[model samples]
Target: MSHAPQAILARPALLFLVLVMASACASRPGTDTLIPFGATVPGAKLVKLLVATNRSGHEGHSAGSASTRGELRFEELTVSIPPQHQPGEIEWSKTTVRDPLESFVVVERQPMNATDFQERLNSRSNGAGSTGIFVHGYNYNYTESVFRLAQLAADSGSLDVPILFSWPSDGAVAGYVADRDAATYARDDLVTLLETVGSAQTRRRRLLVAHSLGGWLVMEALRQLRLKGRDHTISKFEVALAAPDIDVDVFRKQLEVVGKLNPPLAVLVSTDDRALGVSRRLAGGRQRVGAVDISDPALREAAAKADVRIIDISSVTAADGARHNRFVQFVALQATTVVQADAVTSLQKAGAFVFNAAGNVVSSPFDLASRALSSQ
Candidate 1:
């Protein structure tokens, strides 16, 4: 019959969907704009980061899919943030000529061997407060992940040594399945990086932050560590997953293996995360952990029982339309402000809380009673 006419009409709809997805992922600058301009600009802040990755190409500037061998590489970079930069924003160069005063610019890049990398990390770790390791989500190139970590450190005014663990995301909107596979492939390398960080002979704390698909990789790595009886290494860090893209059932199973830590794991979730909504649909209608409704009594009870702190960040406005990056805004606010003890204590417990628009933490009466009971 005449099904050809129906197929012809559907092409435009598919094209429109492709364009929307491209626009959403193309808002940030790509690796072509990552050329280093050695000159420094006055009034600009410099952020230094240690980066580890499993992607092929030069150590200083590698991206795309993982290397066939899946070997680890290391590099250090210094990025200059413009003085006029706002909190929770990475200002890309508007013109071809990168401007350090108006946008982010790479000032220095150095490649390091494994021994040198570990020694450098140890030097930074000795008695220097906490170290922060950031694992970026899907659709991120090497340059974007590097700059975003630099921006986050500068915006939050954090004193922790910043480290970036860049997995092999091809950085394409249409490469979701490929990126997920790459994330799974990079699990061992992530574990190796964690072991190196944990081996440092110091008493400083460590914070591991993963977003979206990176959350899945992190959970798998932690499960591996638990199976290997590396509890001491796991004890050195606190973990936070923001807008994680793992299926609800999968996350529960992973939690069963990963078990609980000294400070409970923090999961930053938003009900209206459009990116996760798409992921949920792609996963055969299975709910993504990051988009779960925290107000649901059953979900809250499960989270509490698992010693997980689920913080609903739906009240915080996202810089992007997708609402997937609200965690960046939340971190900026939490880092800049001196949160009160009650709010801090509530967050430390296993329950649900809300991050209000005013950058304050709100706890429920049930959580308060739980805290009180735990204190006794």
Candidate 2:
């Protein structure tokens, strides 16, 4: 009677059955879960969305607000704007998503006046530190953009002053043209946000971080700001474009125009971005302006002329994937935090504008890698 062998064989089947049952039980969705918003911490100010335009402008209005001091909760679900523009509810439920899938959750959902938003940006680091405004790329919803911003902020650790500006994105690959149109339509709103923040006497130093088509929006907004700023006592704002979907010639011209305002700018690019790669293919198979690896002599010459700082980020990565989405990618966030901290430090000490190969302006000597290298 070899009962021990039977028991050992039976144990494996028992374990497998237990595991299957456990997974099945866990797969059941929750019927009721309320996602909380606004102030996980006391006295924290929530971000106010200034403009919200979906398929129908104003006809489908949605707004909510929350501060940096909060734990934004989500129940693995999507928030949809009803046709009648009803006050949408946040319900909790279990969601089964494949790996590499993206999800979005709203921590705070309120739109505010332009002036109030400016005041909050200035107060983050006593007007002495650097401020960051992140403009997300294409294929992103408002909810997704906000959470991505949150993830970037959390990962950055040092970016105490961060702002997320979510535009009305179509959130589909086929909607690239549509998103571009929407971005153009929303340009004025973007400009207003920048101008308000730029006019802040408290925090004079700021940097813009834009990805994919968001880069075009940032550049356009900056170009507008520079046009306005040049006539008055307006100082230029620093900017960084990560994986922009802009034509090289157009981007170059943008730099030439904005360079007059003397704001520091950086372009972060990667070679492995599939979306940008496909876009380049569709645009006649030429290497993208944002691809820093191609060694375009014209672009290099332009960078030399415009003094742009082109940081090749193709080699960087995070746990999720390659740091293609700079904002959400942890390593990219670290690099970004360094840049911001350096900018703040420079502002604290009053630094001058320094340019790089890709028409970027490093405003402070303290913030320049070259300077650090020289010192080392």
Candidate 3:
């Protein structure tokens, strides 16, 4: 890789930064810190969203006995703060990123029940009638999950409501198996949320975004929806799976079934996903679907049949060395001013395209970045 002056200065830092940013092993051997929720950045917009979780919100990554939908909390977040480049850190301040390499600052939070949430959604959504549901993956706590959702909503500039569905995750590498079980156990809760949102309003757009292991949860939930003949509930949804840690073969089978909702299922995949490399080993040599290149004739065929649009972001880079997922960061395509700002909406508006010579199904990164920044 040719190193520009900036690349020489930035690349090595990111090599270390990616390890510090995504690895659960860096901080205290096995403990996950519970950053106090509700910290806010002054002068930033307060993002209000519905949170659904199966974990005991009291902290310590505990899961209550009641696995049914567990609890719903209303959250208001502040995204004006700077990015916490280090892992396990939360910073809420009035600072904005001129560097454009920043994380979402979740300033404040409020916990409320489903009844109250429904009432508020009914009243608030009356104006725009849109909602974005974010399903978090492995090793994420309630705070990180909600904050990530708030950030995406803020950057997207398109979502009216950002909903977070956080399942029980101990946030420890050793808890991977436990997290999988918890995600399976909580499938019903996601189904419940899907039904509620589906029937919430007759006219609206719903976007379901699931990352890493959460992608498995979403696929399972959708499969169950199909089994129960309730797939219609997802009529308004446009689902996107990013860096899904599902077995590639298993995912193909899933697409064979979930393809019933074609055009509705879009996948954002990166070929060089480092985190999934670990998962691929743990799964007994099975390749995780998210890490597979869609260019392979068989894989490409599978995607085509499922009508599953694959946004091959293999060349996509992030300040964090393009390690795990690239869903939240501003997508610049390159270091140039091409895709300068608010990339979430651009990808959404770009919708789903076909695989190109490079096997990427999204718009040319250059075109995408330019269009995105120009809009702002």
Best-performing candidate as measured by lDDT: 1
Off by over 4 Å in 2: 1-110, 119-127, 229-234, 260-263, 294-298, 318-323, 330-376
* CA error at residue 46 for candidate 3, angstroms: 1.4
Better of 2 and 3 by TM-score: 3
Candidate 1 per-residue lDDT, tens place, 1-376, comes to 7785456335543344446556656665645565568977888999889999887774434332233335789988889999898877888888878889899888988889899889888878766355778899988777778888887787655435888999888776656777889998899999999999988766566778889999999999999999999998898877888899999999999999999976788888999988888778767779999999998999989989999988888987787756777777766664455555567666767988777656556322112222222443
Measured against the true structure, the TM-scores of the candidates, in listed sequence, are 0.88, 0.62, 0.71
Clashes of 3: 6
Can you give the lDDT of residue 211 in candidate 2? 82
Question: Higher lDDT: candidate 2 or 3?
Answer: 3
lDDT for 303 (candidate 2): 58
lDDT of 2 by residue, 24-141 (tens): 2333222111143322333322232222222222111232211111111111112221122111111222363211112222333443344555554445547444556678877665
TM-score of 3: 0.71
**lDDT per model, in order?**
0.77, 0.48, 0.59
Off by over 4 Å in 1: 1-21, 25-30, 60-70, 335-338, 362-376
Cα TM-score of candidate 1: 0.88
Kindly give the stretch of ten consecutive residues in candidate 1 with the minimal lDDT sum: 363-372
| Model 3 Cα lDDT, one tens digit per residue, 218-334 | 999888887788868866576778778899788878766665452336677777777677677656679887778766877766666566656766555443443675654422222
